[model samples]
Target: MTIIKFLTLTLGATAFLSAQSSPIRSCGKPLHPKTIVQNDAPSGTVSKENKIQVALLLDTSNSMDGLIDQAKSRLWNIVNTLTTLKYNGKAPQVEIALYEYGNDGLQDENFIRQVTPLTQDLDLVSEKLFALKTNGGSEYCGAVIRDASMNLNWDGNEKSMKLIYIAGNEPFDQGRINYKETISKAKSKNIYTNTIFCGDRSEGIQSFWQSGATIGDGKYFNIDSDKKVIYIETPYDVKISEYNSKLNDTYVYYGSRGSEYKNKQMVQDKNAEVQSASSSVERTVAKSRKNAYKNDHWDLVDRAEKDADFISKVKESELPADLKGKSKEEIKKAVAEKSAQRGQIQKEIEVLSKKRQGYIDTEMKKRGNPEADDLGKAIENSVLELAKKKGYSI
Candidate 1:
């Protein structure tokens, strides 16, 4: 893409990103900010790189109609907002999945519906969300927790963090499965959950839902309004592969500190203050694909790869922050170089990762997860294997 185009997209995407900004630190401060109490990355405070898995658990109860209506209207805003993180990636790579409940919890058989599996494809999530019609019963937070932990593909890479978000109007308590077991399983595996309360807590179901969140080692927030619920967030690990080229400066700062945020407590909130930001979504016109949301990243993959040179240029430029009327040639050179290097690193990582995955695929064919195909158990061992390889203390 041309320089003019890139700048335009970055400017457009920032408004949306402000809402999902991590609460871990105020989007305040220079790249290196002073904290209330400096918690260093040493002592296993954070991970050098970030890998994230985000799941959305929805409430399909009869009363959630208006909430769902607003969801369709504003879903794209969230995606546009997240595009701001593209600076670090061959493209800003964020993978999100969705789940909805309330389809007959009163019956003894099925209560959960897997609208879309965990995916990088955002359109699948959007389609399912739009298709969602409220006509189910017995919304139970515990079921969603258990089902995701047991069935969803939760990536437990040592360099990454796995997050599950459960949103509903009903309390999570009262389910057939052991509620404590559901929460305990998630906590033990480092898969955190965030609960968005949809009903009136004062009416008394609040305590039950809160307790469920406590056991799951997750945070629960009450959403009284549409805007508040749609943007729910928690501190999540973002991979080196997702930052956009336009964000070269921001990427360099955060990439350096990624190791620190790795193990630290990542926090998220429904509302956040926006900081200086930009994303390329506005530059190029999104194509006329049937499932446009999922295809959002299609052409962008090339754009991300082109940034490999840019990544390296930025690393070397050591561009002094105070550009007092610098020449255009100098800035363009730095930008091009940084973009190329970022794309190159992403390419190399992809090669190594694919080679490694090929080895695992072969092994899995022979061993079948080193445990039963059980989701929770499979995730547990996956974490062990990844941590062992990464030289991290689990």
Candidate 2:
């Protein structure tokens, strides 16, 4: 059986950053300079599990607003697609880092900013994407790629798929840093660097975009940045949307950022709805994916269920008002109830989402074969292919 079919068959059975400080002398030992460190995993217990790390470097010059919009609209779809991937029967963790280059408003002289470091919190990634603004500035492909490679803590696991997808319309050699050296460094670190040019395919080839991709054994593509993404509304969209709303009710927020994070969840929901009903439905489907939706930090139920000592460690003041004054057994029972409800809702969404995907797949086939050029399709195709190479069944 093909790897893709193996992954689909398994699903059919189951149904479902850092900082530093000044050094000081202590106990006759000299302290070293405060060095900033970056971690690939989010804080908590570090697992030696395999993962897929993607760094997205976008050119945010005035003309690239369409690219940013596409990223915002397609982020959830990308996450949903990755959830289908598995290695040795275990789903790999997914983390994404975001960078914006070619924006004059950025304080860095190079006009590049690390918008968000590698993180598992997908909500934070969406928040930063929505906050991005475009301005005229230098487009330094090499410089941004070098900075991300050196600064972010990429995984040392040779089996893991680590990648950089840098998209822009500028010439590949526009910056002071040598493109060859930068890409070579990325290759040495086992990071595959894919380049996406926002223009004609021939123009991208002439501009060295294809060469840049070749330097790191990556794929290159040209996309029409201004092309609108078409999301079709399936018959199951309404029920799925309703189920999503009910699923949100299963979350019980706690901790200091509980209220704020809860509000952000609703805000993202609105953001997707404003784009299109189809986009919102896509997000609902993503939330149903086993690996795509996670809220352990601020959601009391998830936190408690994930960590054995989480409930005991949480301060009384940090608990949500509804959970306050409740006994330990009562809180545990309540959280368990919410968790069970969440699982049932997610299963329902998953059943409907499979139908939705089949419909979309049939529609695309009817539309005839078309080359993948847009940001979403390009990344999705590249990721799936590369992941398969790394022994992931997609």
Highest-scoring model, lDDT: 2
For 1-394, candidate 2 gives per-residue lDDT tens digits of 0001111111110001111111211112111101112222311222336666778889999999888888877777776766666666565666777888998887776788887776666667777788888898889888888888777767777877788888999898887988889999888988889888998899899989999999978889888888887676688989999997898899899877788888888888888788777778877876665454567878877677679678767777888888899887788888889989988888788778789878877876788635564687787667766765676664
- Per-candidate TM equals 0.47, 0.87
Candidate 1 residues 28-134, lDDT tens each?
12220001112222211212244345566667677766556544434433333223222122122345556677655323344666666555444345445656777
Name the regions of candidate 1 deviating beyond 4 angstroms: 1-50, 80-92, 105-108, 203-205, 225-394
lDDT of 2 at 393: 62
- TM-score of model 1 (CA atoms): 0.47
Candidate 2, lDDT over the whole model: 0.71
User: lDDT of all the models against the reference?
Assistant: 0.40, 0.71
Superposed Cα RMSD, model 2 = 9.1
